[model samples]
Target: MTASSYPVLPDERLAAGVARLAVRHQGRYSVETVQRLIADSYEQLAANAHVRTHLVVLAERFAAERLDALAHIESPTGGERPRVLFVCSHNAGRSQMAAALLAHRAGDDVIVSSAGTHPSGAVDPHVVQALTEAGVALDEVYPKPLTDEIVQAADIVITMGCGDACPVVPGHRYLDWPVPDPDGAPIAVVRSIRDALDARITALLDTLPGA
Candidate 1:
C-alpha cells in the first residue's frame, strides 16, 4: 500500500549510501526516508540486473534522483524550470538516448529524466556507443523502472514506443514520439536515432516556457 510497504531485505552495504543521502537532503527529508528510498531503489534495480558489480552505487544515484523529484513535487518554487520525463519500453535505448541528448542540449534550462515501463538489466551497448560518438557523456546512465514520484514531478511526459504503459498524469503535457527502437541495431542506425531524437528535442525545447 505504501512505498515503505515494499519488501526490502536488510543490507549493511546500503548504510553508507543512506547516510550520505540523508545529509544531502538534510532539511528536506529524514534519515529513515532516505534509507527507505535507497533500499527500494536497490531492490528495483537489482530485480532485473544482469551484473551486480556496481548495483550499490547505482542504487544510491537512483535514490538521489527520486529524492530530488520528491522534493520538487512537495515544494512550489517560482520560476522553476520545466521538467521532462522520457519513457520507452525497456529504457535501454530510445529513452536513454533521448534523455541524454535533451540534457546535453538543454543544459540547465530544463530538468530531464528517463525511465522504462519494463526496464532491462543494462543500457544497450549501441546506445552508449552512439551517444559517445556524439560527444555526450553516458556515465552513470542505467535502465530504471518507472516510478510514481518521477512521473508526478514532470511537466511534460514524452513517450517513445512505450504505448499505453506510460502513465498519464493530469496537467502534464504528453507527447508520443514514434521513434524506431535501437535495441539490437548497429552503431549507424543508433546514431541516426540519436540525431532524430536530438532534432525532436530541439523542437521541444523551443516550446518550453523560458525558451
Candidate 2:
C-alpha cells in the first residue's frame, strides 16, 4: 500500500514512532507496512489504555515486537534460539511475570514474549514490584495483546490461565501452567507467584536444547 492510502495518526508522536520503526526495519519492511502496524498497535493499546502519557512509546515497542515476530515467521534460519510465549487472561500479571522471569534466567538461550487474551491498560503495579524485588529489569515491559505473528513464531506456547483463549497452531509445543493470577493480590502474594513462576522457568530452561 502506498503512503497516501495509509491512515494518518492523530498523535504526531505516534507518527514519529512510525518513522523510527520504519527506519529500524528498513529494507525488511516498507514504510507503509511499518506505518500500518504502528497505527494498528496504537489503536489496540489505546482501546484499553488508562494513561496516555507513555502510549506512543509503548505502541512503538509493541509494533517492533510484532514486526520482529513476523520476520521470524517469514524467514526461518537454522540454529535460531527457541522462542517461548507466555499467555494469560491479562498480560498485566501472570504472563508478564513469567516472561520476565524466563528472560532473566534464560538470557540469550531463549527468546521470550508474553501476551494476554484480554490485555489490560498496564502491567499490574504489584507485579512490577514483585519482579523488581527479584532484580528482574522491567523497564520496557508492558501488557500487549496476543497476535497471530507472535503465536506463529513461538517454538513453545505456555498458557497460565488463558485456557482455550490462546490460539492453537500445529507443530508448536503447548503447555499449560496452572499458576494463580496475581491481579489485586498483595505484595506477599505477588512475590509468591513470582517465585512459583521462577521455579517453573528453571525447570523449563533445563528442557531446552542447549541445556
Q: For candidate 1, lDDT tens digit of each residue in 10-79?
A: 5778888888998999988877788889989999999989998899999999999999999989996989
lDDT of each: 0.90, 0.89
Which regions in candidate 1 have their CA more than 4 angstroms from the true location?
1-10
TM-score list, all predictions = 0.93, 0.95
Best-matching candidate per TM-score: 2
Model 1 deviation from the true structure expressed as Cα RMSD, one decimal place: 3.1
* Position 46, candidate 1: lDDT: 94
